[model samples]
Target: MAEKEWGRLPEPPREVVLRVKRYDPERGRTWWQEYRVPTYRGMTVLDALLWVKENADPSLSMRYSCRMGVCGSCGVVVNGVPRLACQTQIAAVASRENPVVTVEPLHNHPVVRDLVTDFTAFFEKHRRIIPHIVRRDMREVEEAEYEFLMTPDEHLSIYQYSLCIMCGLCYSACPVAASDPEYLGPQALAQAYRFIVDVRDEGYDRRIAIVDTEHGCHRCHFAATCSAVCPKDVDPAAAIQRLRRIVFLRRLGLWRKRKVAPLAGPLEKPLRRIRAEYPRHNLVEGADPERQAREPVDIDFREEWLRE
Candidate 1:
């Protein structure tokens, strides 16, 4: 059989159909508009929107600045998920065959235009937490003379929670924000926990007091969706749990007060027997026999194996 020669094939251009939710202040009714764009290989959703604004329609309004994820300005609901448009690729998110991308303004906020949502309420809640390091004392000293050194473990403990960019994605996704305007939401409560857990912070009691009420930490139902959708991986759910512990401990008078109460006659008999049989030394050494055996075996094995 004779081999047939194949001709060069043309490159497949990227394209996607975007359903944008548009609203104008002048026009009270909000409507959806569809636009198809020839997408590039590495084109982002923000790029597609910008292309539509420049080439297709000039009046299309959207908010974007850095064109990167850091700015937290280009956040919009993409396919019901709160995402930063600049960071999401159209090819990755949009269906290849259908390619119908739904773009809408973030929920729980007033829509400004096509993709811009007002962040006044978001900032107001953020500012209410006083997201700044409250010093224990204002005593001034030389940098060399006075230094607060922290352990590596201590620094890393709070490092993950410190990555929040205030993007308001979690705030928009929160159900509490929709029902109650003064709920303080996840972001604010997460920030409250950041300061509350700081060992150097003296305002732990004050910060806890702010969020201990009905509209605060107590309001969280432990849905854990806030942590799941967080771009920075700041587990606001864990912070809420820690806050609960703090609140419980505070209410129980476990913070500084120690209460001495006599044990019941029946309880005291068993406890005395346990204390007499185990003793302080035996308790300190631990009750795990396997663990004790493994320690000596591990030392012998390491010495023998290395020598061999």
Candidate 2:
């Protein structure tokens, strides 16, 4: 254990001040505690906390798993900005000279302990939206009927919102959520949009009653901060805007739900399925059946579908 025996470590660990906020619910008090953590290259903020818990202070508490960013459990406020602790590099927010990183719990949620916040309310709001595909037919939902199909364009519309990991960083960054807990907030609204426009989902109308309420989509001020802080790159603000537009369009008389051409109709299959099974009508939704009826032998079912 001689100093010289450990020949000048190629990447010497540097000391950084971790100014962590400590809160005790029983005592009803909060305080900042500082620890000097040896930060090396590629070390994350979560790594620093873990190191302190192991070597420095055993009582130091924080919640994390997957050490990778996917679990969404390591969200914390670093230097006044909410971000995932596992993904934030310590050096990126702290330096050798001014090596102080202020770590606190996420803003909006009630703190469970040192760095863990109670996600009950956030999850309740999420659940209130019924974040799932809703089908009108009870038999089809309970048992398999046919494959739920979607075009690539339809997939693209909701895919971005679907990427949300429910990290709550968006909730932390939202001014509305911080001030008014009643608001459905960006996270819930964006997820509602994920199901709303989905071709395979039939629950849009049901969710509309919830999202169009007082503390719902209307309350968002388009601050765009939610999208900015999202770790998943899901643009929640844009989704809310699109949701508002859809509500307004439906209010007026445009944009009715497209008639679903039944699979059991005259054309035993959709033109796209036929083309995929046969050859090229090669297009988005396979060139609307009504628009082209060039040949009487074309096996068109527009007349039948349109009548319904």
Candidate 3:
């Protein structure tokens, strides 16, 4: 008995323009170059690029491995937003009027070639955070049988943050890094929070102190670009806010008191006034809050001490 046949798959539409940023070390110049590619039905931006590189121009250079977003190798600035080319659909972004998707290397990093950037600084910052578990005490021989146990609630607290794929999108989109390169940036700061909030880590206080510095959590301005462009929905901005709250509470000894400041102007106004008057009344510097609260702190001494 013969079975009835279903309809065949439809052919992909003919051509799409790939506008790429081209740079050659030998030539010492960079320019945009366009290539018209014969794209398939489910073709992605990465596929189109590969097609152009293989057939149209062998000199063209780009980075890719799995042809998937997992490797984070093909992340580039597409139309001003950092996205993985493999995950971006060509049909959706390419247009006849615009008909060209501008592809450039990831920002805030040294460009190696046409689409690849040097990731040494990015990974170096990650390494500086010391992302690891620190055990408090040696477990006894019998106690060693049980691994560190975490509650469901505790796991839920940091579960979203642990999903970071380190695609460098957050780093590229970060305005803080552009203005102040010393700032730790979102991905690294979020990872710091991941460890600081973990119940199993013994060095939570140390980690908090690490992030409380000028280049750490305090540098974040609460801009939500890191959260918005994150492909995995890991809200680094929210994590940073949590870390800032933790730092603020720790400085004020409110963590033990279990009290959070009200959202109204009572607390914020005084703090802002003190900040304006003192300019250098960071809690870490042993600034006397009572003195500052009573009268404006001397900024000259604070600045001299900070320089020291």
Candidate 4:
């Protein structure tokens, strides 16, 4: 038997009007531009937008690196809902009666162009949360001694929050973000909770201090809009609420502390000896072994500052 095509739409290619909110910086104006395009089976919003750019207007501007939903670059407001264009099928959103599909730049962001929005502030908020592992001992972290291991249950605890692609969709749909400029936003707060629950992390005090301010996780009112619009189902609203509860419980001396993951001891055997199938080369023919053995150089400023 032949393999069934899952993405195939029942109907054939049909004409649909793509209404885009276009912004021209040079003209200092924004307007709606419509284009009639043919939509085929398995066609996505991203494909439709690409068709519009290629056939209707070549001057259209947008940011999309990986055409899949993993990059989170093609996030836009479709019919007032924030979604990833690459993941949203045209047939799912459009109908026979209403053949118009409206595409606009994500809300709560400065419009860079027709469909591009500036992510400078969005990334800055994410950076404020310090979205990385933080340990109490800097020397243990820097030395290539042993790896900190977490149990299966502990890893799954923070795995959901770690799926955030920084798409800004949740931020766009957040009511608090719309009203408050200084709010850390759902994306940052969700990440704050991600590392907070990690068994290997020890920067809870520092991170909590940053997020306990006036415009921090406390500002979130549990609207749940962020969770509804998230493509990855990160449930940022729940994370924020949990974050607030953690702060409250800690203040009241009711917070329960869990044991951190233990570090691995010295290896009994060489890595290759333990795992015989481990790749010896860089997956390339005639690759230099010395160059491959060299560790990647990266700047880590967390150890430079004195503990508070």
Candidate with best TM-score: 4
Give one digit per residue, the lDDT tens place, for model 3 in 1-308.
Answer: 01122133334446777789988887788999999898777777899888988899988898888886777788888888888889777665665555677889988877888998887888877877778766555342234544565668878988998988888889988999878877888999999888778776666777787889999999889888988878778899999998889889999987632222121222222211213355454466667777866875433233334456
lDDT of 1 by residue, 147-221 (tens): 444566766767878888887888788887778877888888988888776654556767777888888888888
Report the C-alpha lDDT of model 2 over 36-131, residue by residue, as the tens digit: 888787788899999999998887778898988888999999999899999887767776568899999999999988998999999999999998
The list of candidate 1 runs beyond 4 A from truth reads 1-13, 139-147, 256-308
Give per-model TM-scores: 0.75, 0.79, 0.75, 0.84
Candidate 4 wrong stretches, greater than 4 Å: 1-13, 268-308
Per-model RMSD to reference:
17.3, 13.2, 23.6, 8.8
On lDDT, the stronger of 1 and 4 is 4
> How much RMSD separates candidate 2 from the native structure?
13.2
What lDDT would candidate 2 get against the real structure? 0.81
Among residues 3 or more apart in sequence or in different chains, the pairs in candidate 1 whose N, CA or C atoms overlap within 3 Å are: 14-39
**Model 2 lDDT-worst window of ten:** 1-10
CA lDDT of each prediction against the hidden true structure: 0.74, 0.81, 0.77, 0.85
The number of clashing residue pairs in each candidate reads 1, 0, 1, 0
Q: Residue by residue across 1-308, what tens digits does model 4's lDDT show? A: 01134456455338889899999999989999999989897788899999988988998888787988899999999888989999887887787888889999999999999999999999999999888878788666787488988888988889899999999999999998898978999999999998888888888878888999889988999999999888888999899999999888877878755776668877554333121133574577776656645743333333323233
Q: For model 3, name the residue pairs that clash.
A: 95-99
